[model samples]
Target: MSADAVRYLVMPNPYLSDGVLDVRAVQPADIEAIRQWRNAQMDVLRQTAPISPEQQERYFAEHVWPQITSLEPSQVLVALERAGVLIGYGGLVHISWSNRRAEVSFLLTPELEKNTDELIALFSRFLDLMKQLAFEDLGLRRLCTETFEHRTRHVATLEASGFRCEGRLREHVLIDGKPTDSFTHGLLAVEWKNGQ
Candidate 1:
């Protein structure tokens, strides 16, 4: 769909916290940190190259800021923070308002990936909050994610959060000059409500 055609209902309040991690709207100050993290984790992301400061600035001004201000946005990006420090960022991207569905996109500071236990804890908690935002606050019926098959730990976390494996795309993407398979996962509001 054309960028201009996408619509989203404005969230009354985009801040969410569980007495620890806080998920709030992405702001100007977050773009640089987000760019760095995305660049460092390109192997696990769809982005092929590092984002330039200029490009990041333009993106925030043209695409992201509009979403923050618009009543209807194509995406809902947020900054993940802990004790007022930025840890990561992500949100419901590729949202289809009519279908009430969106793709889950999340990432953390590159350093955190080195610690398995902390990674799982933060990721799992983040997923929980995203679920609340997607299925509860936004009234979306479905949420989905695409993960590279090699990310076993990440995939396990998704499954633990109630997302079921919908399918796997064989050799779906190129990673380090080799074909890599990706798994698609989905979670419905009904299923989430039932604790499935």
Candidate 2:
């Protein structure tokens, strides 16, 4: 791929408002930073397996950095920063060209905002990016996300941001050794545009 195509994978979405919050593509230097934050953050365990420094280092060194080029079409890694400090991160993963779908995931570095204002802003920018990626780039039909059913805060945010509850998975994941139910949410290109 040319530099232009590689650049597109990490480009910041123009729809995102610029200010204390800024989003950009993840770089080589950011790998360690993200790994450290992911390991320390309690909420991270809710989604993925508990991570260790060794695992993080090995994964990036072996898989990510080597074929960083290949990661473009399927995975877009974004870093969220506030005043030069990384406070959160989010991106679309496992982009399926045939199915026209992808999974959205994010993590806030705790102690960022007192209210959901930051979250609202975050999701607003995220959905805008998704719309652009789906409708303009990939011609995708929908995007999917999963959240704990009892996570009313997140669910409310998704609803406010135009995602609809599609279904539920019973005891889908085990967090802190406890089985947790999750709700699957989705947004179609048309629905997202209409909401805007």
| Estimated TM-score for each candidate | 0.93, 0.78
Clash list (residue pairs), candidate 2: none
For residues 1-196, write the lDDT of model 1, one tens digit per residue: 1344322347655578888899887767778989889889999999998899999999888887777656557899888899989999998899999999999998999898878898889889999998998888889999999999988889999999899999999999999999999999999999999984
On lDDT, the leading prediction is: 1
- CA lDDT scores, all candidates in order: 0.87, 0.66
How many backbone clashes can be found in candidate 2?
0
lDDT tens digits, residue span 1-196, model 2: 2243324333334223355566565655666767766766654345365567688778766755554455246766666767677777776767786787788877766554345777667666666665675666657778888887656777887877788999989988877778888898998888876766
Once fitted onto the true fold, the runs of candidate 2 whose alpha carbons sit more than 4 angstroms away are: 1-20, 42-49, 113-115
Q: What is the lDDT of residue 17 in candidate 2?
A: 34
Which model scores highest in TM-score? 1
Clash count, one per candidate:
2, 0
